[model samples]
Target: MRHRLFEEGKATDCEEKIASLGRTPQEITQSLLNAEESLLNSLYECMRKDFELANGGGVSLPGYGTKGALALMAIYVAYKNGVGPFPKDLLDKLNEGRDSQHLRHIRREKGIRIAKHGRNEYHLEDLRLGKAFSNRHKGVEAATFAEIKAAYGYRCATCGAKEGELHHLPQYRESKEPVILHQGHMNPHEPLEAGNIIPQCQFCNRAYRNWVVFDRNGRVVGVSDWTFVLKSIRERYLRITEENRKIVQELISSLTTQLGQLGEGE
Candidate 1:
């Protein structure tokens, strides 16, 4: 099944024009998450994930954050709007001060033919965005989910919360109760597989989503470079996770106290 496109009940995608320049993705994204958001900002998170946003380490990997963001948006906008090349002005707003023509250098340096225009417009290769914003996950079998849960000891790979719900074939269910063990993909860029799947608690899944990839050993093998726009959300995720961590600590302390009381009576 295809992943859900819209957040139910709440309408996003304001289509508000981003006329102002020098706006960071974090500011724009937080603004959207907090109140109403423009179309571009509303979808930045999804776009960030699909690009496999990593540090500009290798030649092929797009530069993390702003560089990747601008390129992906170019491809997405062109294909979606039937615009021949993604417009220059739109790309500019995604990252200000850097002239849009740098996309050509980006295309050359990355060794990927993202094809920038002489006039600074850009478009994705062959008119396809592949998986950006597509949210494609080949659904996992119920038994496989059970196995994954067993493998991970039914605990969240991120923050170990013992009792939680098990979710198979991730659809990113939002919950305030934090009652889910997500079957998460190991490589942020790769598709779901038995080898790559890991169990993460709801807090880990939601908070660390799109920003970090956990190895089978539950070690952080890779991290996405932060964009100015994304840093705030990242902070928000960690802040919430910290609060939950404290709650777990309190529970442990209370349980230990009870255990001591029981020993005293004995």
Candidate 2:
């Protein structure tokens, strides 16, 4: 049986791009999730093409298909978010893969939980939708969220994004660890601690999970390099915006020149 899931940092061919830019897997996923329209389109197109080629135009096989699945997911998301119409041809091929015997076997054998409202049918739109507020588990105290927001100056501490959510630095879902856990432990699940919480934009916050901090000596450690992480994120954000700015300026110049030529003709 074969099954696939789009885990972060496992997107098709994203590793080479990340390696070429000398970024951690975490950073690459974060950037892709938060990328501007032009960049996101480029990333999605590359992933889509790669997936098609890798899977031989969607010939399903009994293999772990994480890369191709994530590539399709990335493409689907870019199309769904007002970027463009859904690519029906690509979607059709994906549907074929979904109906493959291997996948059917996995679906029947594995207990894939489906929400009651969904009736075992998954919708792409559900990717970005938040869980129902009523169904949400207890999170950090409201007081703590406010305190963290105030401390971070109501901005994403890493990228300086003004609109961001309070994030537990190590994330809360890694284990069944209590919201408050012992400090000075390896990948300690310390949710709600002032020091363990940071402001992060929704995209960056959701890009990765089960995060672990490591030291130069390859030891699992708690969060400590705040200055370094923040500096890196800020630099990357500036770079992305700067590139987009150049593209926008070029587009405007081309349009204005074309309009001037049209006026001369008139």
Candidate 3:
């Protein structure tokens, strides 16, 4: 992969020199292309390392097993091309035939709102790649059992057990089945999408398996059905706990007041 850059770098260096003299549309185009290529290469290397560590082996180049790598590459490309922080339409284009597309689509269609900070911009929206990647856990393995444990404050969502392995809510392996578990909103491929992933105890995760999808109020939607369960969970989880509720409410009020003071920023 590094060797592929010799020619690309030479072309980009030439374009850079030309741009330094004066800016032309052709030079600008070349510069953008160079930036895109550089971004893609960097992103790919990161993805490769992540894939190898997650799978517990060095990944072979040019294989179908690296869908996550490909997805990351596509996202890098879109970002470089100025098509992102990607919304649903651009994500659909990048993920045309990939299995991860379904998860991305679902997130775009039903995910909650969040703010994303990028290199040169920020976005606050329901569907955007900046936030998706921003929330991603660094490294090769999918959200490790340890990270999930920490995120949920070392307790299970079901039954509230403090000791257990972090389970992928909707089991990644079983995503293809007609009746899939909607453990949470987290997509296996996009580990950074915070809303989709959650903590569950070993017993609840295993016992429920595909049988215990739930809504925000802990009402059981039918087994293997994730739609209602996700909706319910989001509503329920969005609430602040009694101990922290006042602080959170005060913060929201303060932020709102500050935003209102910033004249013409909106």
In order of appearance, the predictions have TM-scores of 0.28, 0.19, 0.25
Q: Which sections of candidate 3 miss by over 4 Å?
A: 1-70, 80-83, 97-151, 158-210, 213-266
CA lDDT of every candidate: 0.52, 0.39, 0.41
Tell me model 2's lDDT, rounded to 2 decimals. Answer: 0.39
Q: Which candidate is the best by TM-score?
A: 1
**For residues 1-266, could you state the per-residue lDDT of candidate 1 as single tens digits?**
11122224443342222212114433332333243345545455444433433222322344434555455654543443334565666565555534555555555444444766676566655421222311112222345877878766777765556545433323433333645777776777776777667777766676767676676645566665445226765777434466388876886799799999999999
Off by over 4 Å in 1: 1-143, 165-178, 225-266
Query: Of the candidates numbered 1 and 2, which has the greater lDDT value?
Result: 1
Residues 209-243 of candidate 2 have per-residue lDDT tens digits of: 33545321223344444454456668874344763
Off by over 4 Å in 2: 1-143, 164-188, 214-266
Q: Look at candidate 2 and give me any clashing residue pairs.
A: none
RMSD of each: 19.6, 20.6, 18.9
Candidate 3 lDDT for residue 216: 25
Ranking by lDDT: 1, 3, 2
lDDT of 3 by residue, 36-155 (tens): 545445545643454355446664332322443343343333323233343433323334533244333222332313234443222223212222222232222335656655655666
- lDDT: which is higher, 2 or 3? 3
Number of the top candidate by lDDT?
1
